[model samples]
Target: MLQCGVAIAAMLTVAPSMALASADSAMLPRNLSPWGMFTHADVVVQTVMIGLALASLATWTVWLAKTVELRQATAQARERMAALEGGASLAELARDCGEASDAVARLVQAAAHEASLPGASWDSDFKERIALRLERVEAAMARRVGQGTGILATVGAVAPFVGLFGTVWGIMNAFIGISQAHTTNLAVVAPGIAEALLATALGLVAAIPAVVIYNHLARVITGYRALLGDASAQLLLLLSRSKGRPAVAFGRAG
Candidate 1:
């Protein structure tokens, strides 16, 4: 009986020691793992990532919408100019192109209005005046075409550095935590580094699309500018040829 009692006492002592060791291991905080570090990262890093994602989506959406609009504008302007060059009257051209929102139509309308000005007879200088008016119309068209594209330029130029700032901030915090804990384990430093990298990746995700779309939209806007300039030149040539001639009245006998 004494031997059995001694055995029970010894087992009880061994079990408590094992439990204490397990509790200490658990209390060591899992070697300060990356997952634990990430849980403590600044909220601002997450906010920046969210913002970059939103910016990328917005830029791509705008790029798609603008491309379709510019393509349609170009095709319609081409068709309208071809009809005008085929000797269609201004009124007929306007009616045929009523559905078009191209810069060419605005120039044509401006010229028609100038021609209808009272006491402004068609003279040698009429073409010059009409050309000047067309220039103004072209400028307006350019402004319209370029609207909202500046946002892409701003975002592309700024997003990378913004991400870099987040990376730097995160790395600084990681180092500070390492210094405090006096540990170099992968678990201790990985989370902060991963959080930092996430910012840079998000920034690039936002910036690359912005840059690509900006370039594409710029080319489309350039093409529209060229089309408008060509249409204006053609209108001026027609005006020069019709100088000193009475304006042809449409839909009414003069």
Candidate 2:
């Protein structure tokens, strides 16, 4: 009789723990990894993640394309500046530089055209007119080279908010779920909370690099514009030096 009573007591002690273990196990998330959380996340949360990912992809693409573009363009502009410093006449530089579409070439072309105008030698505002043309060309070149960087700025400024929206929506959904299930168990609530935070994590993932890349590209573009400015100054010097040789800056070259 006493042995039977001990067995009954042992079962009573172990039974609730066993049942509770089973309940806890049931509440635990099957997958808590990032990819797992994403897959199991609410549809709205998933959409936010996907958008942030695309933003990140755009950021990286801009980085790669702009890096290559700036490298080649800066090198070319520097070479042209070196030529400008050599005091090559605008007419000579025009033919030697080739391709009037590049920034430096266009500067030379603009000066050449302005200097070759009728009565150019007698025009008291000759250098001033050429300087105006060079300035316009420089502004246009800066705008062109900076074309794609705007997207980076946009992403950096907006992505974190996008992620926060996902998190808020997710946490809201989690609370709704907890209310419906009529429980405040941590096990029941953690998965949803974790999944929601993942969106923010992805947001940071998309934003930080975008901000960094934008700043870097800005610096590169500033350097390029400075090079353009130097070239313009050199062209003006060439014009001043050619005062004794009037045809050098004022007449059309065949």
Candidate 3:
């Protein structure tokens, strides 16, 4: 009789907890995919994930546009540089540029404009002023070419932290679920954790490519700037050679 009473008491004490654990376990999903996990995530976590995905898309988009722009600019600059070095006159070169807004074209036009000014004699002061104009044009062109890349940098730097915030929010919800369910079973805890980790994975997916793209574009831009520098040097060379001749004489020869 005493043993029977003890057994009954133990069963009464443990039954509720076991039932709670079973209920919590039943509530967990068996198969989880990225889409399913996202759908099942807390609103905040979902938002973070969506934002990261959009950022990743934007990174690639910028990479595509900027890559094309840089390639065309570099090619045009090389062409103009070749022509400039081959003793093409400013009027001829400007005609070749022909209102096309490539960086090299802009540099040539700016230099040509400075050269065309009335009474713009070829002296130290004249060269200094032309040099200043070329510098401004180069700086402006660099800034224009680099416009959309800053967003990629920001995305690369901040995405992981945004994912971490999502993960933290998810884990907090998991703990809250544990409290409500009154259970600590692996089945109940694992699903929430997996979902939370997916956020971090998404973040890395978004960030790593952004960082790589940003670096690649930076290098390409640097190379493009070097090409511009070469073009500028070629222009200065032509100016030096024309020191004693009439500017019209140089323009007429080419």
Candidate 4:
């Protein structure tokens, strides 16, 4: 009988404590979704997240713009290269090319201008001059096409470290909160830890695509450069073959 009474007293003592804990649990915030954690994160962490998101946005934007530009440029260049194979003289080729502002068109115009110079005898030196003009145009066009790609390289190289900084800052804040709260409860610390990791995740998300895109763009640019080289070679061949022909051949397309 005494033992039963002692057990009842112990149960009575614990009942109210359990009820109070249940009340506190009900009052605590429960949703731990990513957005929820982000919304509740420290200001510095939030800034880091926002910056990373912007970087990712920039990466995709560049990818889209460069993709469109490369596709059009490659198509035009291929068409012009095919035109070079037709037995069209420089004058005829220029006329057929119309007033297109493409690099190859400028190349044809430069060769014609050099040929038309009164001093331009259809000699080795004349060919050299024509080659030089085409080279300059090629270089200029390549630079123009590659103008905005540097940012992708910059983002790829720096984004991870930026995220790391945010993660460190967030973890630091979490530790401070742990000190203030004087508890090792997972509930108290887990959200901050998760927020810190989210920053790192965002950084990787921004960086990886930037790197892949930069590399892909670089390869496409190289192929485009090769097309320019082939065009230059074909033009030089045409100039050389017409060397013995009448001055009229050089008249339009030296």
Candidate 5:
């Protein structure tokens, strides 16, 4: 009778193991399983992710290209300006600039034009007009240097939440599956959770570089703006001195 009891107890333990194994097998996701949660994700979510990725790439590309162009342009402009400071005429400077449309050259041309104008005054109103022209030029330069950066800001601001949304949707789907299956089997939940996490990871990947690049480009642009402002001031000073006027008095009059 004791031996019979031992056999029955062993069978009881083995039976539960077998049942659990059957449940796991049934819940296991197939290798060919569909995209599951991702499949159910709204098209907007997918589009946001894709657009973020593309924007990030575009910003990086523009940053690299503009960095090279600006550096080269600044170097050339500085070289030409140094030569001009040593007494080269405006006509000479323009000729040397040739096909190069550097910012400094443009400023010089504008100044020369104003100086040559029949009724151009060096007084306060004239200076104000010159300042307006310079400001417009500065704005144009800023726009060129800052191209494609706004998208990065948008991505940085929105990607994390987009990822979270995707994750939440995926988790909700996983819970629904668990409820339908009436089992707490890991196989039923793990795949959905993994998919959800992947979206979040992708979102972060899209955001980090965009944020970094945007900051870097912003610094470069700020430096450029300061440099242009200084150059514009120097040009005005040159005009004042050439007209046999004191710098402070001329500036105040303008």
Candidate 6:
């Protein structure tokens, strides 16, 4: 009888430990990974996360394409300006530079075309017209070069809010779980809170780089526009020198 009583006591002790161990195993996550969190996240949160990721990709793509285009354009403008540094006639420069979309080349061609027209004059009025045309070209080139940058601004402005929405949704879902489970245990709450904060972290990850990239590209584009203005000034100086001279043939073969 005494041995049977001792066995009952041991069984009671072992039973509680086994029950606690089972509870702990159930509380712990099977895989505490980002991909796992994503898979287990609410549908709305998942959608927001996906959208923010795509926006990040768009920011990088625009940065790459615009960087290449702006660098090439800035270099070409400098080269054209250097070619004009010598006493080369505007007609000679235009022919050698060809009829590409080069800012300096186009400016020269426009001036030459105006000069070739019947009744064309090189007076204060004529010079004003040329200056106006140059300004229009500058504006157009600026617009063209700045295309696709607006998306960066949009991403920078919206990504954080999108992430915040996801976080709010996640926390709300966590509270719902708490209410359903009828418990305030740390194990029950920590997972949901961590997941909610993860949304905010992802948001910062997406937004900070987008804002930085947009500002950097803005500065680079501004510099490129300044180069275009310098090219316009150089062309105007060439025209000023040739104002009273005989008409020069442009695009003539050497």
TM-score of each: 0.79, 0.88, 0.89, 0.87, 0.74, 0.87
Could you say which candidate leads in TM-score?
3
- Tens-digit lDDT track of model 6 for 1-254: 99999999999999986775566457545655877777777898888788888888888898899899988988988888897777677777767766678676777677666666666667667778778878888888899899999998998988899889989999998888778666676776777766776787788788898899999999999998898888888888888887877665444221
- Better model by lDDT, 3 or 4? 4
What does candidate 4's lDDT look like per residue over 1-254, in tens digits? 99999999999999986775565454334667878878878899999999999999999999999999999999998899889998788878777766677878778878887877776677668788988999998999899899889999999999999999999999999889778765656766777788899999999999999999999999999999999989989999998988965554334432
- Which candidate gets the maximum lDDT versus the true structure? 2
Identify the superior model by TM-score, candidate 2 or candidate 5.
Answer: 2
lDDT rank order? 2, 4, 3, 6, 1, 5
Candidate 4 ranges with C-alpha deviation above 4 Å: 1-30, 246-254
lDDT of 2 by residue, 92-207 (tens): 88777565477888888888878777657724577799899999989999999999999999999999999999999999998987887567878878998999999999999999
- Which prediction has more favorable TM-score, 1 or 3? 3
> Which candidate model has the greater lDDT, 1 or 2?
2
- Give candidate 1's root-mean-square deviation (CA, Å): 6.4
Model 6 scores worst on lDDT over the 10 consecutive residues at 245-254
lDDT of each: 0.76, 0.87, 0.84, 0.85, 0.66, 0.79
Measured on C-alpha atoms, candidate 2 has an lDDT of 0.87
Clash tally for model 3: 0
Q: List the residue pairs that clash in candidate 1.
A: none
lDDT of 1 at 125: 76
- Model 6, residue 109: distance off in Å is 2.3
- What does candidate 5 score on TM? 0.74
Q: CA shift at 9, candidate 6, in angstroms?
A: 12
Q: Considering summed lDDT, which 10 consecutive residues are worst modelled in model 2?
A: 245-254
lDDT of 5 by residue, 158-202 (tens): 877877786777677768877887777777678767766766876
